[model samples]
Target: MVESILGYSPVLRHCFRNVSGKQFPRFQVIKAQAMELAKEPGLCKEKERYRDSLVGLKPGSWPPKNRADNPSLYNPLARQERMGCGWLGAIFEWEGVLKEDHPDLEKQSWLALAEEEGRSPPPGFVVKRIACMKNEQAISEVLCWSRDSSQLKRMALRKEDIHQALQGGVYRFRDGSREFVNVLTRHKIPVALVSTRPRKNLEEAIGAIGIEGVFSVVVTGDDVYRGKPDPEMFVYAAQLLQFIPERCIVFGNSNLTIEAAHDAKMKCVAVASKHPVYELTAADLVVRRLDELSVVDLKNLADIELTEFGSTPELEMDVEEEEDDRRPPSSAAIGDGFW
Candidate 1:
């Protein structure tokens, strides 16, 4: 009876029979099926409402104001086009690097640095601190623990050991990132991996994820004098890919990366896997999962002319501020200019 109702294999049926509560299992399965069936009407109504809302809007002006916050606004049927150049930011948390290693040590290091400076760490420091740590400036400014004592060297050694261990371990791809990359490859879009991790560690993580050759270009923290919240990495990536900054679409999960993309005058899609949707408001578009973003969306974004959104005071301010903060350090202190 179970096999006929649910089409379970004989092996599954045998296992179900071995269970003492057969009736409860059968009832639960039937209830779940019934509930799913009952949801169809509501689902259809929601979809119809979404479609109706798009009726009079301009083409490609989807995600109506009412549905802006709804992640289900992803239109699978939306048109797809061949994108010129694509820049993919490595989803660090999804790669299992954060899970396998402790970010706490790095956080502690930053806090210690803050203590030495006799100042409280700024709010949202960790968001940029982790990325900054990859740059030599961070080591010189925030992590000058060596000057204090040998204890700092031991801490640094322990951190190095953790990173080494991460290189040997495997990294799990985010739920839909692999499929998303496959789609981009199939469309022949040139995608580059821009990351805040050091090149060696970034390469190792990419290799562990089994996508070593997926990206045409890989830019790491070691490649740039500055890190996130700075457009240097993204601009350098655009240069390496031979893409105009405005034509490239950046997909990132952090506020700093999104800001970097905007500063570079590139369209950015914020993946809210790491941060909340509200926090990612700076992005051109926000989605709860990578799976929600499709090739169609990329094409639409790529075709958008920057002039459509006239320059705003806030945007101008952001760009100006970035430029102000990006002054070239002395050659003796930090080498050449950023990028």
Candidate 2:
């Protein structure tokens, strides 16, 4: 019995690790719930109106009820003030009214709503609060974007042209890429790039590398409802690749990108393209260069293994994997003369 438990110690460690983290399961669950509520078909107009009202209004003059019915009497400037600087009480009360009046929102997931907003769900909701324990580490991650490859930088192509070029022989192969793409192709696991740059830049960069065919998907900010740190972009990438967020591995150097991956429930590898390894402490795994990592280095992140009684394996993998993958490759090994 002792050996059995000891053998499964890593799974226990994984749970404890998440529990010890500041955001843990609560924030994740809530955000998901809120998105569910937002997708209600009947509540579309009400949600849109609520969002509009909050978008440009100031702090002190928010509407207490639906402004559409009594537009003539509504104080637009005062409303703006309220939105800009309203106390939490006022904001909560008004938002409550907005939700209450929206018939579509009547059946919406309140627990999800509260969680996305990082607040407690109101009374009458079914969600049990994921309690915040003391001394939890803050959940933060990076959202990095690589600089445009040299060819794209020189051409200054338009976004549409970039996308068009990507499908054909538009991009040409050159330096710096042999290391990143060659190794991944050798392993048979598809490698994709997620970027916040314009489509044109991405297309040119891919073409320059001459390995555009290697990727199963390339997700950019234009394809998402929101940019990095919001989770939409990463989620879209996972969908396009026919991969679950948990099964995906992200390589990035930005705080926003890292946070976005974390929010999507994906494992992230931080690459030190522009920043030093020490600055990338928030990443789950930090790599100084891309060459040091291979397919086997990411085994722990392949899938979520469940224990018999219900537990996930601890992420006992060493930080060395992260360190190795982050380093730029040697020139002769991968053909990346740019490095």
For model 1, the run of ten residues with the poorest summed lDDT = 78-87
Question: What stretches of model 2 exceed 4 Å from their correct place?
Answer: 1-177, 307-339
- Cα deviation of 226, candidate 1, in Å: 1.0
What count of clashes does model 1 give? Answer: 0
Model 2 gets an lDDT of: 0.45
Query: What does candidate 2's lDDT look like per residue over 189-224, in tens digits?
Result: 655566544565566655654555766677664465
